[model samples]
Target: MQKQREVGNRVFVTGIGLISALGNNVAENHSSLAAGKDGITKAVHFESLYTETLPFGEVKLSNDELKALLHLENEFGYTRTCLLAVKAFEEAVNDSGLSAEELSSFDTALISASTVGGMCLTDQLYDDANMKFEGSEYLEAYGCAAHTMRLIEKYKINGFTDTINTACSSSANAIMMGARLIKAGRAKRVIVGGVDALAKYTVNGFNALKILSEFPCKPFDENRDGLNLGEAGAYLVLESEEVSVGKRKYAEIAGFGNSNDAHHPSAMSDDAVGAIISMKTAIESAGIDATKIDYINTHGTGTPNNDRVELFGISQIFEKVPPFSSTKSYTGHTLGASGAVEAIFSILSIQYSEIYPSLHIETNMEGFDAAPITEFQSDVSVNYVLSNSFGFGGNCTSLVIGRVN
Candidate 1:
């Protein structure tokens, strides 16, 4: 075991909120994970023409269903992306026991991330563009930052607010930024995470990349072809040690690292230099040895390139790699929301002392000696979980989440 580091001030994960294909909230998601049940399958809620051809990790609810659940007025302009974000954010705020006044305080900050934003309505956007008379209701909500901006205004959050667009690493950076704000005394509390709704735009984009799997993805498997796109929203409430007193703290933000390989726009280098640096930096920042990590939440997207390169990075970081798996097997690759969604899973691993499994490995990956945990593990006593998120343009990030004593 590695000696744990002593620190002056600590950031604590006080609350978590998540909605994915796996479940509607944290409890539901945990149940599904414990059963080793995968939520990925043929798309039911997504509206792509490839709906029957390509598998997806799609939320079961439709836009109208989500609106009904959220109880919005008929004429409300909330896009599907914003609706998903508000659902998770509301749950996180309620879980943290924050009142309306507390939410709007100047000391409270909000950091949310998303890539699809309002592009879920691509058809409507195109039609509106061609029409000269009336503009679409989604015109203002059609950017990468639209979801976060809507959330900010919805909750009347008055403190610092920002949006990130580093592809898959967006929400990990959001959580990291939230921790820094608290540590630097810039805010007493911060709500950070990400959301991405399945859209024709995103589906077609990934299809064009030739990385969309026809069947359920097999992450880290030799025959892994590509990834299944997923949609989800996840958020975590981080409070300084002083403010977190008497709260239901889940874990500590022990360490985080961000790096960009700058190697390619769509693929990582063979050695995964950015990924290796990210994990190493995170471990160093956590004041622990590389071997001390108990498990890893790998950024295994199941694509031929991603799985191999990520495994290479893991081999470089640990002489004997820890028991790790890609939860994306269950939720699929959630793009911008992956980091925050997987972070919640990491915190759950600590809280429950269990490690969830990576679904469907027909054969071991070639040239890789280590394999993902294929079955759910219980009573494992996980203390440290290193969650990795690497995105397009070689942007990589890792977060070290530790059990709170």
Candidate 2:
């Protein structure tokens, strides 16, 4: 019989890096959260009719500049997707304090999450009439997996790597996958995260859905409209027990769950069936009761249906609803990157005991009493944090991050 996997392998997070509209790296992101700053601004990165028509949390990096910083191969056409990811990856690797030579000591791997890889490159190619592709090589790389391969080669770290594209839940699912890999003894150390840069496609797609909010998103608010699209990349390196010795471990990925409502292509079930199942599964896997969840990082996208359904799920399950926050208003809806972006917030919450508030909350929606802590808060002891990420296709994930030692 296959050995019943107890939480035998202790997976601890050692390194973290973030690049969001709110800030760059850990310090900036943390400070923005504290100041209750909303990073949503009018579109300036790309020329779009959606400019002020739709606001976004756009990063301050340009594609050419990013390629130079990452020292990307000239032969390979770099996109905003790869640029954002490498920025976060480099920061996380530095935070881990492990050089490329040192990484050889452990079985390290990368699992990246993204929905559109080189689509930005694909979209912008038309602008350059001089550019020509005689071979179909660029076509395959246009898909989301292309960035994962880029990350593996760029970093010179080797083990296993794959890409996940479960919409917004992608990176949270990536975190779960890293822990599973460690649990299965597949890799000792894993760099798992997600990255996505703002593009007209996503903006137009969500706009077509009529859910793109022009103003800053106000999740769980009575006046909340919908999410503001954003660009970002956030990554964390997870290490198994032996690999984490002497490292400054931030928090432990205690347990995680990924479930699907499969109810609709874009909309979630009004009853939050998927979220309920996912939360229960995650808490159980963490070997904790619902009451132990000290804080929750909700998948609050500021969407009309999501806010109502998610709150309903939390209220129905946890007895004393934990103080929850959605950093989306600060970073905007980061598409696939939202999962990992918020995971960084989740870990920071555990480390500093700071409850990052959900910005732009004007009023609480009916039936939801656990509204966001509109004002910033600090210095709270939290043992376990339930970070929830839900995405299109009803893909829902709940990750339990616990403080180490």
* Candidate 2 local lDDT, residue 110: 86
Which runs in model 1 stand beyond 4 Å of their true positions?
1-8
TM-score per prediction, in order, is 0.97, 0.93
Per-residue accuracy of model 1 over 223-309 as CA lDDT, tens digit each? 999999999999999999988999999999999999999999999999899999998888988888887799999999999988899
Model 1 TM-score on a 0 to 1 scale: 0.97
Instruction: Tell me the number of clashing residue pairs for each predicted model.
Output: 0, 0
Model 2 is weakest, by summed lDDT over 10 consecutive residues, at 122-131
Question: What tens digits encode model 2's per-residue C-alpha lDDT throughout 210-297?
Answer: 9988788989899888999898999999988988988899999988888899999998898889999999888888877788888999
Cα miss at 328, model 2 (Å)?
0.1
